[model samples]
Target: MSLEVPRPIDPSLHPLVTGNYRLATPAIEALYELVTRCLRYRIPGALIYGPPRIGKTRAIEYVRLLLARQHPRMSSYHAQCEHKPRHAEGPFFANLLEAVGDHAPHAGTSAAKRSRLLLRIREAAARSGSGTVLLFCDESQRYNENEYEWLRDVHDALDRQQIKLFTFLVGQQELLAQKTALQVAGKTQIVARLMVEELAFYGIRNAEDVATCLNGYDQTAYPEGSHWSFTRFYIPQAFDAGYRLVADSGTLWQAFEAAHHKASLPGSLEIPMIRIVKDVSDKSPF
Candidate 1:
């Protein structure tokens, strides 16, 4: 017996496959508003804290795109913090350099790397019409006290150049604990500069929230000019038959509630986007 060759699938058409898509959600929109307010006031930075797997990182990614579209000329950079047994200045600056698109991140001493990073940021700010630059530090709960101080140094240096630097520190709830720790330790300087503002990112809280996300899949097209949204691309026949992911919102929400009760999980039923995405992509009834 002979089997027909399996058809090729485009990764871009499948978010589950490529993991390169962001949905428009109320939480993300709220986060964008908070960031814009900070930029408007030249606030040093804000802390975006939330529970794990609730899409804070995804919100950051989406908000960065929004920043580019809305500001047009402002420069933005993203650096991911890592869990360090001990803080090392060299690698920390290297991470910043790499995030800012430096060609030789490892080619200099700690001070030299910092100098280059500042130069690049200054150049970026100069190129911008607004003289502003934004930095997003993900996984920032791993950052130690010294890291925050070094960040303050960068903020001060940029201020001297008459350029505004706004940082968005995105991490899990430990970030709040860190902030309180700083405040308790009389590190008012760090708290005032970096943690003045805070935002709590949340997940789907109700059926309406589920519908909003489902609507995104219904409207978002894949492959840059195709009419096929992620939902349609995966189930063309059902899509043509007037089937939409949004129509499944009630069922999806009910499933989440049932599972929460089954597991005896505490707290209100807040469903993480990661879990919803997994369920829709992997086990949707359609």
Candidate 2:
């Protein structure tokens, strides 16, 4: 059956979004890098995993918009876990088909129908020399082990249909936690709730990744403790200034150098990107 979708609102305008993000240039470039790699050769998939409310979904959406604007032929599907859990075999597939088939003459009548349409869509996508098909699932923590297994089955069935297909899953630490928790306690209700294990040692890969990610992050108007690209010292601001410094741009280290006649460190002003995204997006700063 054609799943009934609720009325749509622009997620970009949501409060959690709205000029409330660091540049995340490295992550954005990482996605763009994936796109380039996929078209040239073929990369299976990538997951933009991070902590909850860390702008994973927004950053991904921005990348998707970039793809749509630059490469209209490349197709994409975005499914929110809160909605449309239709179909037994492939719930994720059903959402994928919805975005892929949007604006088409015929939508799917059932999950199987959507699956069939998606195969044809991929074929058409390749022949036309258009955009690639990217299946993005946000809030993936809501997905159960059974749902993930179903997605794996869908990929196996359809992998041969096209030369390249990519599935990007974005979820919080809770997603990983649920699996670990399940392993600890066989059957638990916590799986339905968004939860995941922590990634304690996450940092820049090489010097290149750091440079790119830092600059790409929107530093202007960035807050302390969250938007790292905006801060300079990266230390507890209140300890030094008696209040958190909120300078979105310019180098405070340079000022210190001018005063003390000494060179300051490179990462002296990295406002916590995660913290800024959360706090700024909550209020109507725009």
Candidate 3:
């Protein structure tokens, strides 16, 4: 049998077919509100936990961009916790220092490194002409009791220095379990500080939520002064030329429903955002 060549993608439809798009789902809106409240009230720290592959990371990224635009002078730092054999405090503080553009020392005790990190954070805040520092820690479920205590120490230090530091701990559902375990183990202070509010991210529940997601892409503007509506690109000949169309067409809704059914959990009737997008992308070629 002869090998078949793949057809080249049309230039006009490139943007819509590729790249991740941000939709203002209810979870994302809740995240925005959480951040807004934290910044407005100068809250010390908060935790955001959700299931895996449900757009938690994407929501964090969107929040980062939103904060950068809204508070240009605020300093933002992000650290991804790793599951390694080494002590968690070392890598955690090192990553924090690196995120703020400071070099972590190669030869120092953990306490020394942490002290240096505190100093660096102060310097970064001064350089940025603002005392507000936002720290986003992803994969926080890997942290143990000691790691939680370390974070509390950092938060306390920032508070004593009069710096407004807000830490957002983003992780999977186990994050709550871990916090509960800490509380049960008599680590109430850590639980009190980090568990101010746990924002849980649930997937799309109804057709209106799906419509909101599709409408986001539909309203998005392309470089050619046109919208990226699915009805315009996918219908009327999947590969043929057409004008922009509204999202009211039942075609896109049916695709979303099918994808949701396929991706929903056995007992949990929830559909992850990633699965829906993947289903849409897979069907775009038709």
For model 3, give the 10-residue run with minimal summed lDDT.
Answer: 1-10
Q: Estimate the TM-score for candidate 1.
A: 0.87
Clashing pairs in 1: none
Identify the runs in model 3 with alpha carbons over 4 angstroms from their true place. Answer: 1-21, 86-88, 104-107, 222-265, 282-286
Candidates' lDDT values, in order? 0.84, 0.50, 0.72
**lDDT, candidate 2, 168-254, per-residue tens:** 666776656656666587543332221221222122333343444434433432233333323222232432453333332224334
Query: All candidates' TM-scores?
Result: 0.87, 0.50, 0.79
**What is the per-residue lDDT of model 1 for residues 38-78, given as tens digits with 9 covering 90 to 100?**
97786888999888889888888888887888888989988
Error of 3 at 45 (Å): 1.7
Which residue segments of model 1 deviate by more than 4 Å? Answer: 1-16, 235-243, 283-286
Please name the candidate that would achieve the greatest lDDT relative to the true structure: 1
Instruction: Tally clashing residue pairs in candidate 1.
Output: 0
Q: Candidate 3: count the clashes.
A: 0
Tens-place lDDT per residue, model 3, 1-286, is 1113232345344555665455567788898899889888766778899888888888888778878888899988878777867666777677666766776443377777799889988998898899888888888888877888888898899889988778888999998888788778888898777767678877776666777666665665444365434444454343135333324435655655676578773664566777656656665644
TM-score order of candidates, top first: 1, 3, 2
- What C-alpha lDDT, on a 0 to 100 scale, does residue 206 get in candidate 2? 36
